[model samples]
Target: MEEAEAEEQQRFSHRQRLKAAVHYTVGCLCQEVALDKQVQFSKQTIAAISEVTFRQCENFAKDLEMFARHAKRSTVTTEDVKLLARRSNSLLKYITEKNEEIAQLNLERKAKKKRKPEDENRDFMELDADVVGSDS
Candidate 1:
């Protein structure tokens, strides 16, 4: 169908754009000076860097998918990501810190929501209704 073809084209275009962005970022970083000396990367070096980075990203994605599937999960969780980063101690540590930070933030937000003025008003209204009904 034309719709399927269009969707496939869009996906291909999106992938190409992502690859180009990766290439550009790698090129920019490669040009940065190191140890007071300017650095330069040949086209082949840039291409190789981009290729390896992209391949790793793809492998990570697949691993995440498999991890989720193995757990019968429809969506990936932080545990899955942490497992994926198990090969790198620093990365795993960083991910654990971030996960804890986010968890703390979520708990604070939930507590704030539960303490809203409207919640107090609703409870008072319910209590008042029960008292009035009993009197009647």
Candidate 2:
């Protein structure tokens, strides 16, 4: 039971690290894209990057480097970070895909319910005709 608890803690820690990586990665990318001097950061500088804990900075740097290399980009931009964040993490990707799917399903449901006035009128006319014929 203790072993199981330890494993769970390790798993949770890993997830937290990944989430921190993504957040820090985005913050760095935002700094780059926005060209804001107010936001200064370096991979070695942990205190500057508030999104990630000091211990996680090393891992974040490694992950960010790998992602940058995979993209074959000389500089990491917000778009690249976003793509990396989405691609490297299954949970993030799943959530994003699920959200998009839900949105599409909702749009389809709304479209299906949207009847043209002409079609509605035709149905009403048919019903009226049936009622009159029955009365006769």
lDDT of 1 by residue, 34-79 (tens): 3237556789998999989988998999999999999999899999
User: TM per model?
Assistant: 0.77, 0.31
Point to the candidate with the largest lDDT: 1
lDDT of each: 0.92, 0.69
Task: Report the C-alpha lDDT of model 2 over 1-136, residue by residue, as the tens digit.
Answer: 9999999999999978876776677666757755755665555553354545544666656776777788897665544445546746885677567767878999997786775666799899999999999999
After superposition, the stretches of candidate 1 with alpha carbons farther than 4 Å from their true spots are 33-37, 118-136
Score candidate 2 by lDDT.
0.69
Residue 69's lDDT in candidate 1: 99
RMSD of 1: 5.4
Deviation from native of the Cα of residue 80 in model 2, angstroms: 11
TM-score of 2: 0.31
